[model samples]
Target chain A: MIDLYPTRGGDEPRFIDRQDPVVYGTAEDGPIDAGTLAGFDRDGFLTIERLIEPEEVERYRAEMRRLGRDMRGDERVVTEKGSDEVRSIFEVHRVSEVFAELVRDPRVAGRARQILGSEVYVHQSRVNYKPGFRGRDFYWHSDFETWHAEDGMPRMRAVSISIALTENHATNGGLMIMPGSHRTFVSCPGETPPDHYKHSLKDQEIGVPDEDSLTALAGKHGIELFTGPAGSATMFDCNCMHGSNGNITPFPRSNVFIVFNSVENACAEPFAAPSRRPEFIASRDFTPVL
Target chain B: MIDLYPTRGGDEPRFIDRQDPVVYGTAEDGPIDAGTLAGFDRDGFLTIERLIEPEEVERYRAEMRRLGRDMRGDERVVTEKGSDEVRSIFEVHRVSEVFAELVRDPRVAGRARQILGSEVYVHQSRVNYKPGFRGRDFYWHSDFETWHAEDGMPRMRAVSISIALTENHATNGGLMIMPGSHRTFVSCPGETPPDHYKHSLKDQEIGVPDEDSLTALAGKHGIELFTGPAGSATMFDCNCMHGSNGNITPFPRSNVFIVFNSVENACAEPFAAPSRRPEFIASRDFTPVL
Candidate 1:
């Protein structure tokens, strides 16, 4: 098959136009309204305040804390490179019922199905925990590049929903996405080493776009920080250029992140990597969410 | 379109021999061993001691307590008849991450897929809470009957797994199943009333087998109580005649119960009811567990 969004091979990054549509379904066909759908299509992302209730947010925060503490030795629990603090707990929906319910919630999964125009399944799920002082940053990159190269995801028919479990303020590290950057797929260059995810989960160094490319994308599209109260959420396209800064604030930051993939675009063999990432990191289970 | 396992709208209870194979997959193709598979085929159920670790059991117990305390007034929380005590929480896998992880656990979902010989989805899941003294009895009946009549489950291609979160002693009202009773599908007579699950969940009065039929089945197969320590699990066929008495013991009995149905046997229109039961009670989501 042709590698439309190729990555992890070569010396310089390659930019390619996105071949997929941003919004696959119309408001007439799903729970989202036309105006909101249009806005999402234009910017490649959308933020909703209070997408979940306060009680639900508290429950997820509790679950996040529990998993962070209990899953210390588990491989799926990725820790910060420098500190032992947990950076993310992968496959959280499969492990946590609170996040699992959120993955199936209408505001999240319904919108995903609508955006992809098909039944959706979880490709990946995690509780990103940015602890108070020593929290680390996740470098800027397109999720689709890694999913395609390392996880064997066939296309950009996926959407990610990150729901805030704690209040996200300017000081606390929150997600920053380049509006309209999803229109272009930045194919980072480098051969993915064996077991790349083991290191990448903690500190990604491979397949990161060059500084020039990052600067160009940010300059052209502009960066937007997703800041909102607990229970707020942001849904972004798979190829959106996004990352977060390290949190040094007194207050912690946490979110339940879920990636919903279209069943029609199920994964295949990796396009660039030596092997596919683990199921907990990038699920091979393509059973569509109903 | 014929009603093979017909119930309700009939005058007398009808007993039909199970038409499907009990063990669908060979041990060589699945995680279960040949000896265990043979035993399950013969007795229609198998119990594995310490199916989960003690720590995991305690975690689930904690989750159970939390759900029971906080889920009041939620429709999915079924209170005991004539009391405000929470009897059961339906679609528990969808509501609580702890139970959801238990549902996806290899010993649970993997064994289910092997027994059904197909990718399986959660047909129903609930945390059965039988508190001391006020805990009500769940009358003897084949789960397949209610599923076939009200939920439109087509065949006996489903299995139920109950994992004890607390020590299950005789006094605490553990499950009791009629050995080899699954071979006979006792088609109970009576038209299924609309919204039957509302009453049936707390205290079942509908789709129950006649006493004579139950007596004959018990007389032939004999009854066995599943008494075990916390973390032990029992997997039983859907058509097995089973029930549990009220717990009068101070040590309350609770178990995480999940039903896995083959993806091939997804629900159709109600075979004998006015409308299908709600999604939480009888899930319409047919996404197979991977």
Candidate 2:
């Protein structure tokens, strides 16, 4: 299994050789292969080296930035800037073919299918761009709060993918993940009463650490920051605890996040409420595939 | 809003007012108007009196018993006689014309549409039969877990409907609900670990409550215990806390449950990954209707 954390000094990210192409051809074979999937089942998240060609990553980044600039003028974009500390171009998946192409990419889809085992569908998609020195880091939280309200057996969707269009380094403030945090289901404050649920990790308790300190803690428990060049991507279970620091680099940190789910796991309606756009409603259908 | 709990102790179980055809009609001034949706939302759950005629309910009950008997010999049916305390026949919506008619019932469908505010689709249908003296009571819990996951927000589906095929009363274990429970989210313990995502009523601890105590709690919180003769139906929010007590009477308690979700909020997959179903796959454009 790919060790989630490498030795302290060797913290620099290294690329692993791609596995042989399977029934569904994609670089996903490296991260979601039999071995990787088994590891993810136990570990909750996995990062693949060079899942996309470096050039392809560069192209996606350039195209996304252009789309983001164009969307700024579109009236449909509802900017919730300070709330999340990041500027997002909402509903780009509906208007931009580039965004649609990334979501429908066969490589990503194949990995999702293999992981979920059931027919899956696109629940939603978004593009987030973090301008350097412009925002506070996002709070650490799980993504399943709105969807799974009824308590029963645990259900999981495949890891949501965040493709780094820009090099995510210490200066650019890449994503940091808590290893084994998926096992810690922290009740979201305010969303539900604290007495009703228990939270293992609190936003106030997560102290920001330098690269050296991060590597040290990560080495001890296999926790690590997802810092790599522009072409790399990180795939994490939706339930895993993850958040990133603010970008302090010279350039803006941008990425395209495409979240997918298994078809058998139908989402609640309020979770996928339609955008105000008539076109979005015209094309979007909420029926479960299976 | 029709008050779920009338201060008067003798308020009889209200059946759908079929004689006032407007309430049951398709006209703008229908008896069961979608505008009544606001009332249903405030009340948490509502019963449409006489949703099915008494004769039809008898026929359905008889048919279910036959199906249960036939299943005793079928390998696919997993339980033995007497061992089958609570037998649920699945996918009746796809197999039974009666279910189809009920799903399309405008009086029911229109109200569901307004509450969910989306084009709704029948997610699944089942017949639950609780045999007299041999039936097991279900624990208090919410319904959202089976239909959706935690991540997808704004809940796609709004409510679930249980149509009574036999008289439901204290002796036969009618449904019991915790009022105002839907407003708050509680985490329950799951099979994997204590922290696994589970939702329940916050004010009450998890354990089986005696019938008298359970009924009293419902009454205290303005909760409602739905008791009625054959042909009545109760509709409740997916997140509401509810369950039934064992039948103490001589007769079996039987009901047909038809769950629907707004088509716009319908998901191709249920959210949250339970450890039991570890399989995950990427979603595809497999929604039957879209």
The per-prediction tally of clashing pairs is 5, 61
| Residue range B1-290, candidate 1, lDDT tens digits | 67788887778987898988898988976778999999999999999898999988888888988988888899999888897888888988988877888888887899999999999999999988887534656778899999999999988899999988888864445787888999998988878788888878876777988877876886688667788999999999999998765543345688888999999999998898899999998899999887
Query: Chain A alone, TM-score for each of the models?
Result: 0.97, 0.67
Off by over 4 Å in 1: A1-290
> Would you list the C-alpha lDDT of every candidate in the order shown?
0.84, 0.51
Worst 10 residues of 1 chain B by lDDT: B243-252
Q: What ranges in model 2 sit over 4 Å off? A: A1-290, B1-31, B34-36, B73-82, B150-156, B191-222, B268-270, B274-290
Top of the candidates by lDDT = 1
Task: Give the range of the ten consecutive residues with the poorest summed lDDT in model 2 chain B.
Answer: B15-24
Per residue, candidate 2 scores C-alpha lDDT tens digits across A1-290 of 22221111222422222221112223344335666766666666767667678878777777766765666656334343444333655555666776676666666766766666656666556666776534334444445432332221124453477878777754344666666545433332222222221111112221222233323333444434676777677777666655654432234577777666665554432212121213221113433323
Model 2: how far residue A168 lies from native, Å = 64
lDDT of 2: 0.51
